[model samples]
Target: MSVKSAAAKLFAKKIYKKTQGWSSNPIASQKNVLNSLIKEAKKTQFGIDHHFDQIKTFEDFAVQVPIRDYEDLKPYVEKVVKGEENILWKGKPLYFAKTSGTTSGAKYIPLTKESMPYHIEAARNAILHYIHETGNADFVDGKMIFLQGSPILEEKHGIKFGRLSGIVAHFVPKYLQKNRMPSWETNCIEDWETKIDAIVEETFEENMTVISGIPSWVQMYFERLQQKGEKTVGEIFKNFNLFIYGGVNYEPYRAKFENLIGRKVDSIELFPASEGFFAYQDSQKEKGMLLLLNAGIFYEFVKSDDFFSDKPRRYTIGEVELGVNYVLIISTNAGLWGYNIGDTVQFTSLKPYRIIVSGRIKHYISAFGEHVIGKEVECALQEAMEGTNARVNEFTVAPQISPLSGLPYHEWFIEFENEPDDQAIFKEALDNAMRKQNMYYDDLIVGNILQKVVITKVVKNGFQDYMKSIGKLGGQNKIPRLSNDRNIVEVLNIK
Candidate 1:
C-alpha cells in the first residue's frame, strides 16, 4: 500500500475507537454533550435569558427553553447580523449559512468558530468510518470531486452569508485541497450551469476516486460526462468507487445512477443541514444513519403527529422509540436552543440511535386528509417503477383541489428519463402503491370522496426548467415532493 493509504487506514482506526463509545452508551454520551454545550453558552444573552445556570438536567433545559422555529428566533438572528456579541453564541459568528425559507425570504443560520469544527469533523468521520468498516483506504490516494454551490459569499454587517455547502468548501482541509476538484474560481461562479460546465472541463481526466453531492446534481454531472465522451461514467473515471450523497432521498435516483455508472459502487448517506451535522451512515450493514450522539448538538424529538398541537410532548434520546415518526429538535453549540429545523425523522434502530429521514415538516400532502409524507411518495414511486423500465428524472406531488370537472385528487408531475411502455398501467400502479401504503387514501377513494390520482408525464427537463426559472436550480434546492396546496403546481403551468 502507498504511504498515504496506510496513514489513512491508521487514522480511520483511531476515529472508530474514539466514536465507538457513543454507540455503547448513547444516553450518557448525549448527556455529556448537552452539558458541555450548556456550559459553553451559559454566558450568552439567550443563555442568561433562559436561566441556563439553574438548568442541571434535560428536563430543566426543556422546560426553560420552549421549542422555536426560524421565525420565532429571527429577532435574535437579526441582532447577530448587525454585529451583536453574545446574542446567541459567545462573541460573533464567523459566517451565516443561508437556507431556503418557508414564509420568510431566507434564513441565516449562525456558523461560529466553535461550531464550524463540528461540521468539518462530522464529514471527516463519515469517510473515516466508511474506511474503517470496509478497509478501503485507496480512495485517499486519488482525487475527490464535490459538486457544491457558489462560494462567493455576500456580506451583511461584516458577517458572511452563503449556502452551507459553499461555506463548508471554504474550510476544506489544506491537505485535501490538492486532490479536490473544481478550482476555487470555478466554484465561485453563481450560475450552476456555467459552473458545472467549467467543472466538467477541469476534472474530465483527473484520477477521481470519490464523488460527493446531492444525487440529482451528481447525476447531471454524470450525464454531461457521458455526452462529452460518449462513454459511461465508470469508463470515463475508472478509479471512481465511493459515492457520498445527502440533501435528498437516494432511492428514486438509485436505478438511474447505477445505469449511468454502468455498475454499482459503495454509497453513504449523511444527515447534514444548515443547522448542524446530525448523523452519518457508519456501517454498510445498517439501513439508516447512526445519530451523532456525542456531537456538539444535543437532540430532542417531538412526535410528528403531535407537532401541530398546542403543547407537543418532547422526548429525549432515552425516550425515543423505534419506528416512530418524530420531528427533531436540537440545541447546538451554535446557540440554536430547542430549535426545530422542520425536518422529520424516524428512529429505525434505538440501540445505536439510527434514523431515517421521513420528510420535511412543511412538505406533506393533506388536502383531503390523506396526510402523505415524502417517505411514502418515494416508496410508492419506487414500487411503481419496479418490473418496468421507467426511470424518474424528477417529480413533484400536489393536491388538485377545485378541479374543473371531477372530485379532488392527488396530481403527480413526473419527468422520466425512460418512459414506461404503458402510461395508463404505470399510472394505475402508482395509485395502487400509494393506496396500499396510506389507509386514509384508500378509504377516501373507496368512499368516493376523492378521485383517482392524476399522473402527468411532463416534457423532458420540465422540472429543471421550472427550477431554473425560479433561480433555484442546484445545491440543496429541490422540488418539494409533496405540497399541501397547488401553488407549486400552478407555477409549473401543469393544468
Candidate 2:
C-alpha cells in the first residue's frame, strides 16, 4: 500500500476504536443525549413554552411535548426563517435544509451548530465503521464522487437554504477534499442533467474509489459513464469499492446496480434526513443500520399501525421492540420537539439498536384497506424479478381509484432496462409475491374486493422527465414508490 493508504487505514482504525462506545448501552446513551438537549434548550422560548425545565425524565418529556409534523411546527419554523432568535434552537439555525415536498409544497428544516456536527460525524463514522468491519481503507487514498446538489446556497434573511447534500458538501473534511471528485463549479449547475454531464466529463478518468448519493441519481451517473466509455463502471473505476446510499430502499435497485457496476461493491445504507443524521450501517454482517443512540437527536417510536389512531402509544428507545414497524418521532438539538419526520422504520436488533427504514408514513397504499408500504412493495418486486432476466430501471405504484371501473386495483408504472420476455408471467409473479407478503392484499384479491394489479411499462426516462419538468430532478428529491393518490401517475401520464 502507498503512504496515503497506510495513513487512511490508521485513521479508520482510530475512528472505529474511539466511537465504539457510542452504542454501548443504547438506552442509557440515548437518555444521556436527551438530557443534554433538554438542559441546553431549557432557556430557549420553545423550551420554556414546552416545559423543558420540568422534563426530568423521558416520560415527563413525552407528556409535556406532543407529537408534531412539519405543519404543526411551521409557526416556529416561520419565525426562524424571519430571523427570529431562540425560536427553535438557542439562536437562528446555521442553515436551513430545504426539503422538496410532495403534498406540503416545501419545508425548511433547521441545521443548528449543535446538530450540524452530528450530520458530519455520522457520515464520518459510517465510513470508519465500514473500514473497521471490512478492513478496507484503500478507498480513502483514492477519490470519492459524492453525487450532490449545487453547493451554491441561497441566502434568505441571513439564513442559507439548499439541499442537505449540498450543505453537507461544504463541510467535507480538508483531507478528503483533495480526494473528492466533481469540481464545485460542476456541482453548482442547479440542473441535475447538466450537472451530471459536467460530473461525467470531469471525473471520467479520476481514480474513483468511493461514490455516495441517493441511488437514483448515482444510477443515472453510472448509465452516462457507461454510455461514454462503452465500459461497465467496474471497468472504468477499477478501484471503486464502497457505495454509500440512502433516501430510497436499495434492494429493488440492487440487481440493477450490480449489473451496471459489473461487480458487487461494499454497500452501506444510511438514514440521513434534513432533520438529522439518524443511523448508519456499521457492519457488513448485519442487515440494518446501527442507530446513533448518542447523536444529537432523541428518538421515540409509535407503532405504525397505531400512528393515525387517537392517543397513539409512543415508545422510547428502551421500549422499542424488534420487527415492529414504528413511525419515528424525534426531539433534536435543532429545536424540533417530538417531531414526526414521516418515515417509518423497524428495529432489526435491540441489543445495539439497529433498524431498517420500513417506509414513509405518507407514502403508502391503503385505498382498499390493504395497506402496503414501500418496503413490502420493494420486497415483492424483488421476489417477482427473481429467477428471471428482468432488471428494473425505475418503478412507482399508485392506487387506481375509480368507482366506474367496478373494482379498485393498484397500478404499477415500471421502466425496465432489460424487459422480461413474458410480460404476463412477470405481472402474475408480482401479484403472487404481493399476496404472499401481505394478507390484506391477498384477501382483497381472493375475495374479489380489488382487481389484479395493473402493470404499465413506462417509456425510457419517464420518471426522470416528470421530475425534471417539476424542477426537482436531483439531490434528495425522490419519486415516492407508492402513493394513495394518482398525482405522480397523472404527471407521468402513465395509463
Candidate 3:
C-alpha cells in the first residue's frame, strides 16, 4: 500500500471507533443533539418566537415549534437572505443551498457555521465506516469522481448560494483533492451535457477507482464513458470497486448498471439532503444506512398515514418503531425547526438505528388507496429483474384512472437497457413481485377494481428527453418514482 492508503486506513479506524460511541447510544445522542440545538438557537429570533428558551424537553420543543416547510418559513428566510443577523440561527448563515421548488418558487436552505461541518464529517465517516468494516482503504489512493452540480456560487447580500453538492465542493479536503477527478474547469461547465462530455474526455483515461453520484446521473456518465472508450466501465477502470450514491434507490438501476459496467460493485447508499446529512451505509452487510443520531440534527417522525391528519403525533428517536413508514420531520442546528423535509423512511434495523429512504411523503400513489411507495416499486422491479436479461434503464409509475377501454390500472413507463426475450413472463414476474410487496395493490387487483400493471416501453433516452424539455435535465433533479396523478404519464404519450 502507498503511504496515503496506509494513512487512510489509520484515519478510518479512528473515525469508526468514534462513530461507534454515538451509534451504540443513538437515543442519548439524539436527545443531546436536540438540547444543544435548542440551547444554541434560543437567542435567535426564530427561537424567541417559538419560546425555545423555555423548552425543557422534546415535547416542549415540538409544542413550541410547529412543522414548517420552505414556503412556511420563507418570511424568516427572506430576512436571512437580506443579510439579517440571528433571525434563524446564531449570527449569519455561511451559505444558502438553493434547491428547485414548485410554483411557490426556489427554496434557500441555510447552512449555519455550527451545522456545516457535520455535512463534511458525515460524508467522511461514511467512507471510514465502509473502510473499517471491509478493510478496503486502498481505493483512496486511486482516482475518485463525484458527478455533481457546478461548484460555482452566486452571491446575494454577502451569503453564497448554490446547490448543496456545489457548496460541498468547496470543502473537499486537501488530502483527497489529488485523487478527485474531473478538474476544476470541467466541473465549472454549467450545462450538464457539456460538462459530462468534458468529464468523459478528462477522466475516461484515468485510473478511476471510486465513483459517486445519483445512479441515474452516474448511468449517464457510464454511457458516455462507454461511448468514448468503447469498453464497459469496469474494463476501462479495472480498480473501480466502490460506488457511493444518494438521492434515489439503486435497486431498479442495479441490473442496468451491472450491464454497463460488466460487473458488480459494492455500493454505499447515503441519505444526505440539502436539509441535513441524515444517514449513510456503514456496513456492506446491512440492509439500510446507519442513521446519524449525533449529526447535530433532531429528528421527529409522524406516521405517514396520519401525516395530514389534524395535529399528527411527532415521535422522537426513542419512540420510532421498526418497519413502520413515518414522515421524517427534523429540527436542526441549521435553524430549521419542526421542518418537514417531506421524506418518509422506514427503520430496517432498530438495534443501532438503520433506515431506508422509504419514499417522499408527497411522491406516492394512493389514487386507488393502495398507497404504493418508492421502496415497494423499486424492490418489485429489482426482484423481477434479478438473474434475468430484463435490464431496465429507467422507469416511473403513475395511476391510470381513465382509459379508453377496460378498468384503469397503474401504468409503468420503462426505458429498457435490454429487452426481455419473453415480455409476458417479465411482466408476470414484475406483477407478482408487486403483489407480494404491497397487499393493498394486490387487494385492488383481487377485487377486480384495477387491472394488471401495463408496461409502456419508452423510446430510448425518452426520460432524458422529457427532463431536458422541462429544463430539469440534470444536477439534483430526480423523477418521482410514484406519482398519484397522470401528469407524468400524460406527457409520456402512453395513451
Summarize candidate 1's per-residue lDDT along 1-495 as a digit string, tens digits: 899999999999998998877788988988998899889888999999999999998889988999999889998998998998999889999899976444445678999988899898998899999999999989898999988877888998888988888999989998799999889999888666677778889989888899998775687688789999799999989989999988777776688789999899999999888899999999899889989988788899999989999989989999988898899999988889999988789988887789998876778875554557676788889999999999998899987755788666898988888989998899899999888777657745764556788988777778888899999998999998988777777767442
Candidate 2, residue 393: the lDDT equals 84
Name every residue pair that clashes in candidate 2: none
Q: After superposition, how far is residue 469 of candidate 2 from its true place, in Å?
A: 37
Model 3 residue runs over 4 Å out of place are 364-495
- Cα deviation of 366 in candidate 1 (Å)? 16
Each candidate structure's count of clashing pairs: 0, 0, 0
RMSD of each: 13.4, 13.6, 13.6
TM-score of model 2 vs. true structure: 0.76
1-495 per-residue lDDT for model 3 (tens digits): 888778888999999888889989988899899889888988999989989889998888878998887778889989999999999999999999986442244678999888899999988889998888888978988899998778999999899999898999999999889989789988888766778889899887898999998775687789889998899999999999999998766776689789999999999888888899999999999899888898888899999999988899999888999999999999888888889887889999988899998877777776554557687788889998987898988899997765788867888899899988898988989999888877657756764657899999988888888888899999999888879777786776331
Any runs in candidate 2 off by more than 4 Å, and if so which? 102-104, 364-495
Evaluation by TM-score, superior candidate among 2 and 3: 3
